[model samples]
Target: MMIKWFMLLFTGFAGGLAVGCGFVAFLSVLGIIPRLMQLTKTIKWIRLYEWAVILGAVSGGWFSLSPVYLHASHYWFIPIGLLYGIFVGMLAAALTEVLNVFPILAKRIGIDDKIVMLMMAIVLGKICGSLFHWLYFAGL
Candidate 1:
């Protein structure tokens, strides 16, 4: 029994570490942080950005997996939701930028001249979907 519990704990820790390392490696290979810094002209704040990413991942993981909950007011969720949206948007933008996905997609689809419109539509769709999800699900 003791050995079984130890093995379970070790396996869980090792699996988590492997997944975490792969996630960080993916972001690094995609050059998301560096590209973001370059685009924003905030290269000097690279360390700050790196630390923010690390802290955010750690705190987010803890908050998500732990049974503890903060009984914050509904108003507090506004800023939290905004931050989540910004993070997701940045990640999606980084992925698209790294792969030149939008341009290639537009050219392939013969919408080269309407690339901006395509992007705007995607953004609007994301916003509307997110809003609908929260509004509809919150009632449940």
Candidate 2:
């Protein structure tokens, strides 16, 4: 095999974590997360929030797969890719929530969210990377 599974797994996790943290930090700095969290307070804007997540996931899925992306002449590819994107976005949101919610843990653990984010990213990346690797190896 030209690829090592463990390396890919490690790299995926690290890369994902970095990207996730950076994305969250970027959102937080923009005050978007607070605004987003506040959407739960009222009945309004929740739909907007949901739509944002869906859109984010869809966009994420599209970009990530775009690299080695096959030409999708089939109509199903778009919808299917969107579903995968939704999955990615949800997973990413969950990771962001965990780190943002807990500050004391980082102090106590003497580590940072960077590491935590990295771990989370690794998991998300690993899952997705596995799929990618399989596709690449299988000549899909």
Candidate 3:
């Protein structure tokens, strides 16, 4: 039982980290956020805000997977988790824009025409991370 729990936790953490990093890298490549905030003083705060958003996304995704991971045995759960992450990420971005919320994040990250692209990257990362556990079970 203890091993099972550990496995679950490990899976969750790995998924979160993978998704977060991938999403951030994709955003940088797309020029949605500055490519070199590491070198810029004014945009330094944006890096912090970006981290917060990615962390929040990872947490949200992990929570979303908890029930399925605990109860389901099907490998399709992996793809489902990925799809869920993508859906949630896109929804979060859209809702934030439509509601005019997340102004702090927007201001810090430097808004561009590529918001949709960035959102897609975030969603894809989330899904890919969750898919790992799904594939693990499939091997079993």
List candidate 1 segments past 4 Å from native. none
lDDT of 3 at 33: 41
CA lDDT of 110 in candidate 3? 88
Query: Which is better, 2 or 3, measured by lDDT?
Result: 2
Clashing pairs in 1: none
Sorted by TM-score, highest first, which candidate order results? Answer: 1, 2, 3
Q: Note the residue pairs that clash in candidate 3.
A: 82-127
Error of 2 at 28 (Å): 1.9
lDDT of 1 by residue, 1-140 (tens): 99999999999899889989998898788888888777668899978998998898888788888998778998898899999899889878878888899999999999999999999999999999999999899973
Cα RMSD (Å) between model 3 and the true structure? 14.4
lDDT of 2 by residue, 51-138 (tens): 8765885588569857766676766765886687765565455545545644555556666756677557656786688678756876
- For residue 85, model 1's alpha carbon misses the true position, in angstroms, by 0.6
Model 3: weakest 10-residue lDDT segment is 32-41
TM-score head-to-head 1 vs 3, winner? 1
Question: Which residue segments of model 3 deviate by more than 4 Å?
Answer: 35-140
Q: TM-scores, in order shown? A: 0.92, 0.34, 0.31
lDDT by residue (tens digit), candidate 3, 25-85: 6565454344334323447488675786678776777688676545766676657766777
Model 2 scores worst on lDDT over the 10 consecutive residues at 34-43
Off by over 4 Å in 2: 1-3, 33-43, 66-140
